[model samples]
Target: MALPFLPAEHIPSMFDELDEHGDNDRLDAVMAYVFSIWINRSVFSMECWSIFMKGVRTKNECE
Candidate 1:
């Protein structure tokens, strides 16, 4: 399955908001937000791959 990509325009504002908040606050918020999203997506993708591979193995075993 293909992952939906974020648009380029959306990226600048996230960075801009981070910049406006200054170094400390921005760093904390950015790290928290980015890592949260990253972890969630990583888990989701892993689950998807696990299911897909299981399906493939089941099909192969039947064949």
Candidate 2:
């Protein structure tokens, strides 16, 4: 079955970006930056959704 709550292909790329620095702490910090920015914003757009989905995919794969 497709991975629960996520499609597989996107997951790898998302995690790949997060892991590119080869440090989990750096990855977490970058992720927190992205999410904190999104959360502090009010309106949602397709562009925002795409960016948010990157975080979602990474979060799911990490789980």
Candidate 3:
């Protein structure tokens, strides 16, 4: 099975971003920030889901 979010190219970028910080504390901070953004954009708003669904619909239409 394949992953849902993020393309394979983005995975390396994400790991690089995580590695940019010096220590575990800094890495945790970065991850926390990212998690907060994810929660706010994905869980806190219906608009995000609506937009994602639209994208899926468009892809399906193309197919």
Candidate 4:
């Protein structure tokens, strides 16, 4: 699959934002951040979001 269109410079900022959340609500914070991206970018649909989240869950499970 093609990588998402985020620019290189935006990555650190995103991580910095994520870092603000406490560990207890980290997953919720991440989902909110992802939803923000979907809303701002307007290229990804809810279907894509759902699939991406499922992948995240699977990855976490494997670890």
Q: Pick the candidate with the highest TM-score.
A: 2
10-62 in candidate 4: lDDT tens per residue? 54456456556636676776656764775446586434544322434454666
Q: Model 2, range 1-63, lDDT digits (tens) per residue?
A: 121224433544554464465557766786566545533355643243444235454546666
Q: Rank the candidates by TM-score, best first.
A: 2, 3, 4, 1
> Which stretches in model 1 have alpha-carbon errors above 4 Å?
1-23, 40-63
lDDT of 1 by residue, 7-52 (tens): 3334435544655666597577765675466434545543333332
Worst window of 10 by summed lDDT in candidate 4: 1-10
Cα-based TM-score, every candidate: 0.27, 0.31, 0.30, 0.28
Error of 4 at 18 (Å): 0.7
Against the unseen true structure, what C-alpha lDDT does each candidate score? 0.46, 0.46, 0.47, 0.49
> Which residue pairs clash in candidate 3?
none
lDDT of candidate model 1 versus the reference: 0.46
Q: Candidate 2: TM-score?
A: 0.31
Off by over 4 Å in 4: 1-5, 25-63
